[model samples]
Target: MSDSLSEAWDFLTQAAAEQDDGCRIPGRSWVPPILEDLVLAARNTSLSRYYPFTSHARLRFSTGPESWIGNGDDLAVGIALVPEGRYLVCTQASHDAPVFVRLETADADEAAAMAEHLVNAGS
Candidate 1:
C-alpha cells in the first residue's frame, strides 16, 4: 500500500473505531474486500485506495402545503462501501437486482448487516 493509501485506510478504520453508539460504529475495522467477479471499479482497487463510510439518513417528505407543515415519517436506510473520492455506494443495472441504498440508523450492527445484505444481493 502506498503511504497515502495506508494513511487513508488508517483514518477510515480509526473513524469507525471511535464511534460508540451510532450507525458509524463498527465492531471491527473494515477491510475492503476484493470483488473480482463484480464489474465494479472498487473491485480492482486496493483497500488503501478507498475510504469507508456509512451512508445514513434516507428520508422522504411531502412537498405539498400539508406536508410542509407536518408530514409522516417516511425514511429508509442502508450502508455502503465506495472507492476513495466516489459518491456512488453501489449500483445494479440488471433487472430484479437489489439496490443497496444507505442505511439510515443509529446502530452499528444494523448498518453492517445492511452492507452485508447488499453484497449478498448480486446483480
Candidate 2:
C-alpha cells in the first residue's frame, strides 16, 4: 500500500481500538479487500494528480430513541476512501447489522463504469 493509505489504515485501526464500545469497531477483518485495491487504483488515475485522496473511519452514534438522533455513544463503525472527491468506496458494520461494501456514484451504471476503470487502472 502507498504511504498515505497505510497511514490512514493505521490511524483508523488505532482509533477504533481505543473506542469504549468494542462492538462499534469494525475491525480489520470487517474491511473488504476491494477498498484497499480501489484506493491504490485511484492513485494511478489523473484525478489523484489534481486532488489528494483521504481515508477515514466514521462512527455512528444515537442519543435518543431514534437511531438517527445525535448521541454521544457509538452505534456502529463505517470506513470510507474518498478519491479526489469524486469516487467513494465505503462500508458499515455493527453487532446487529450486516457488513456491506459500497461504491457511491450517480447510479448503478456509473458505479459499474467507475469500478471497471479502477480495476483496469490497477491492472
Q: Whose lDDT is greatest here?
A: 2
Worst 10 residues of 2 by lDDT: 57-66
lDDT of 2: 0.36
User: For every model shown, what is its TM-score relative to the native structure?
Assistant: 0.28, 0.26
Q: Please write out the lDDT profile of model 1 over residues 1-123, one tens digit for every residue.
A: 232434444544454444322333353424233111111222133321233323332111111212223432111222333322122333434324666544444333443444445444531
Per-candidate total of colliding backbone pairs: 5, 0
> Which candidate comes out best when scored by TM-score?
1
**Residue lDDT tens for model 2, 42-63:** 4344323222223343222222
Worst 10 residues of 1 by lDDT: 57-66
